[model samples]
Target: MRRWTPFVLLMPFQFIFGLIYSWGTISPAIHVQSGWPQATLDLAFSLTPLGLLPAVILAGRALHRLAPKTLLAWALTCFTVGGGIGLLTASPVAFMLGYSLLALGVGAGLSTAACIALVSRLYPQRRGSLGGALLALYGMSSVISAPLFDEINRLIGWRPSLAALLAVYAAVGWLAWAFLPEAPAAPGRQTAPLPLMVLLRQRPLRWALVIVLMATPLGSASFATIGHLTKAIGVSSALGVLAVSLMALGNGVGRLGFGLLADWISPRFSRAAALGLNALAALLLLGVLHGYGVWAFVAYPLLIGLAFGGMAGKLPALAAHVAEHHGEAAFGLLFGAFAFASFLGPFLSAGLGMHSALQGLALCALAAMGLGLAVAR
Candidate 1:
């Protein structure tokens, strides 16, 4: 078990991301099929982040009630069952309810508690790279699932495509139940008081919050808007979808590649570099609005995916550094607080009037980049 710890640690995240996160790509399709105008569809897509607010606030205590393995198993079952419900009905409202339920389970179960807790303790030196690698694996599921879901739709239909997704979730759950390790409870507040105000008073935490607020909106907006940008820039819908596929692939690559890169460079450097890339990515995205032809399709998502990946890869290391520096006793509380920022990413992106949000996104990314460098120094 010790020899296989890393693999076991990462399995739960891979499953959760594969099911819920991948749906961003499918969101437009859901919108079109459900007859909800693009506005409603976008709103529904952003709900996961809204719902995550309360869920992340309470997640540490929720994980304490059961072993991480038990909690993960139950979470995966909820995800599978919710996905199965999605298959049973075609009503857009029904689909929204089903996906939201899955998203809720994902938010609670996939918190920093399990993987971060386990790996940071077991392999403290490698936590950054390991966490990044795990996130990358999560990204891979999106890459693979995007095209697979498309192919599944082509062959069986969306309903069965969802049913198939349920099977995958179930299989991953069983693997988690069978293999994920149970860590000995570390010294900390077993029931840490949620310090909503502590974060407000702490300068370091406030800085971390600013980073997430910036990067997450950048990460999510790029994801949400890439399809629209492609079409508006004159790529056909077919090509827009193709660009989305590449974006997903790039997201995974960013995670894995940058995770490894973080191992080599200082976490501070890794973060600053990520912020810089995000600024560049934002410019590329803004350029697309000017009609860059097929080149825009290739350039924008690639840059966005890379910057988004950099942010994802750097987070675990950043969080772990704060935890170790402040006192591991309060790690869960600190991590949960940091996660609250992740919960805001999608809403920030969508808040930009659906038409010109990219400009706002670029501005936000630049602000985040500047903050990251300051915080690192």
Candidate 2:
């Protein structure tokens, strides 16, 4: 079971991971098809993280009772049904509702954390390596899916493209059911989840979340508005779309690399490096604004994606350090904070404008980095 369950489970979760971040790729199609305003489209897309937040919290709570098969079952059902609704419905209300259900399936319900938790149990000693591999795979979906979505939506259109993915995921999910045997429990798997209040009080996790809150806006903003970045530099939309894929590739690399770095070195070093990368990316964005060169536009996502992906990649230890045996749930709380980034990124971009938004992000990174200097009593 341990020899192959991890590989068996990887396929379905990879498909789910792509869905969470597909907004940047497909939002333009929905906007064009529905004639919806950008704000309305943003709201509908942002529901992904919003939906993921509460569902992850609940999934963490239910870890004790839910069998792996049962959880995987709900994850598939919710995702496909919701995706079906979103595909068929032209109505805004219906689309939003379906997207929310998709979010539920993939969040804590049957998503990344659940699958990663299973693997963590499977290879307790190699949890970091395996978990980071999973995260990198999660990043790979965006790499392939972005350009795939861009081209397919251009050809058969979003409806058929979405339908095609749903079919593929269903087939892969069947493999998970047949081959994903129940993982034996980890040695201390029964430890109680830390109280939310207590979880919040830990210095490492607290500063990490604060870092997530502060640093994410820049990366999120870049991702959400990537097309505009290319446009500003007088480049083609094709390049803009391709930039997204590069960002995804960078994301995968960053997550895998930093996770191993944390294992090889220390969480503090990995975390600080991620923050520095983000701060540097923010500065690079500022330079892009002055029309430095087209390469800056290309480098932006790759660099920032590394930092942004590293932020989460380096954290399994930090979360485990704070919450003891309940790292999955602790990680859930960290995941939820990105929901705020979805809203804040756009708000900052709109209110503060592009230049100020990046500046704010730079300041946020510095603020988070300074936490390392504070005396821990």
Candidate 3:
């Protein structure tokens, strides 16, 4: 396969990468269909990271033994099967089961890990810029999809919406699979891969993973539960779609801006700035949002989105640096922390009452800010 094929195949990958975030857009409809509580819906959102991060771990391992196209094939199959399950409406249990399957597929990190490995190997000299571009597209997926999803869900209902989306994913996945190539030979003195447990024992690597664990879920859990959040704050729940779009905008801008900033300035400064933004967002969640109504919602998602985006962009580069030659260790350790946070965040956010849950998140972010600064030093 040509070197440029994975980059082109990325278009189809992008089509499905952010399906996990669609919970905010479609949860309302799902609630109407199943008569499930907001928290249960959010639980569905939490499943993404569970499926995703583990898939990431598996994909990271599989990249050594399997071709990228093979992994992409697996990912596409998961999405298809998961989408099929999600379309069933026999009962509430069936709907939840379908969502669980879709969550598994949506967050499946098989293709993501495959694509990252392929790109990193094929474009070693330009991986940072290229990866930033990839992250930007990941963020952009939500921006474009949020409104489109809302409109479609509004018009056709969530189940049919899933059917339409699956059709698109199928067409796109077919192209992506046909074109996706394996990682080319890594151009360097190849070190024997280290044991993941041994790598985790190292202080720098361990700390790096902790940072990723803390930073990723700040806005995201709240994002997964956005419709409920708006309703709790006395606004129309549907307004959450607007918040999702803005958050995605913040995310895309931060992905590029922070990635570039890290290259130009320092990851330390960038991380610190990102952490501070997160803390400020927490402050909003803790205090101001209750009184001001919808206007308050605007500031919170944007701040959290930027902070989350900044860290998402900065951390992979940091992991690569901190772990040095241990790419697999980086994927398992640092990225694992990311996947773990994906599970922990929304499960807690939606599980708790809105103000209290957000308040807890606020405190966590502030604590993380202190740890982040200390680690940077």
Candidate 4:
């Protein structure tokens, strides 16, 4: 039981950090209530990734010297302050700043790269399984937070509901920080940290980046646009929230399931399989665009969630596999590059329009499948 304490403690932070995924549900609500233009609302979500990119790059580099607890403290502070600002301010610029700050906090502290690096160091022998479990909670975060936020919004209002969320995040983040054990020192001859330029120059790392660039949009599109897509399909607002919840559920399962699969088989096979799922999800979305029934709504998000979760679960492992020599420091830079691509997915999707976005996702998956196969060679 004591041995399990670290992982158990890590779960809530992962869950809270995952509220980023709940943006699909939250964005639509804000738009409906505030009458903000779609572009402005979309920008709020986009700023998260934009903020995350630099913070993650820095956190990845800094983790070698700083403890996870230190970084997590920073993350908690940013998240709380950002949310507090959002709670107080109604101005679009102010809200964007608040959301961007939250994203920066997420990138700097609670990122998947940080979580994977910390846990893998603690449980070196079980890196794949442990990484997956932690990330699964992260993926599942949306499932729990989205519905809870929706209910809170229904009861009070979006602003107060957001405040309630920040309060919970603060409490949980503190507990996780207090309980998290120090990351064990690297066991073998530690290689010097690779420069970002050198890491990017490697052939396999470049391929991994390509795979991320292609696959991330498929998942992010569903995350950012699902509520609108559900309504477009003539579903009720209540059902739209349900679709977001279901996507998150699928996201959690995919993270756990694919993480374990990568451990059991190989990261390469797991990635290929995930991309295949993404391809199928893209097709499903196409069907929906062509006037498929409610079932298309149901099936589309589940598959995309799985693909997204699996991709998120596997990519870190794949980067580690490709750059094993550089160790955790390198993992941060590699994963940070992938995060940049992940950001582009939703940002572009909002601008491109839904049907075109889905079509673009299909093409990306197909392209990634070829890239995955080539990398395997």
What TM-score does prediction 3 earn?
0.83
Q: Identify the superior model by lDDT, candidate 1 or candidate 3.
A: 3
Task: Please state the error at residue 64 of candidate 3 in Å.
Answer: 2.7
lDDT accuracy of residue 48 in candidate 1: 54
Error of 3 at 269 (Å): 4.2
Candidate 4: residue 1 lDDT (0-100):
89
**Worst window of 10 by summed lDDT in candidate 1:** 323-332
| lDDT digits (tens) for residues 1-377 of candidate 1 | 56666566566666554455666656655655556677766655655545444443445445444455555555556566666665577666665666664544344334444565566556667767887777677666665677777777677756677567667756765666566666565444365533547534666656765676666566666676666666656767887877776777777778776766667886667777778888887767666655554574466677778777767776667654544443332334434443444445555546655446667767788888788777774
Best by TM-score: 4
Per-residue accuracy of model 2 over 136-235 as CA lDDT, tens digit each: 7765665566677788788887778867866676667666766777767644557665677876787666766776787777777776667666786687
Best by lDDT: 4
| TM-score for each of the candidates | 0.80, 0.85, 0.83, 0.87
- The candidate, 2 or 4, that scores higher on TM-score is 4
Higher-TM-score candidate of 3 and 4:
4
Clashes of 1: 0
lDDT of all predictions, in order shown?
0.61, 0.68, 0.67, 0.73
Runs in model 4 deviating more than 4 A are 32-35, 103-110, 187-191, 227-245, 283-298
Summarize candidate 3's per-residue lDDT along 221-336 as a digit string, tens digits.
Answer: 77666667777777655566777667777887777777666556665676777788888887777665557445666688788888877776665556566666756447545555
Q: List the residue pairs that clash in candidate 2.
A: none
Candidate 1 positional error at 376, Å: 2.4
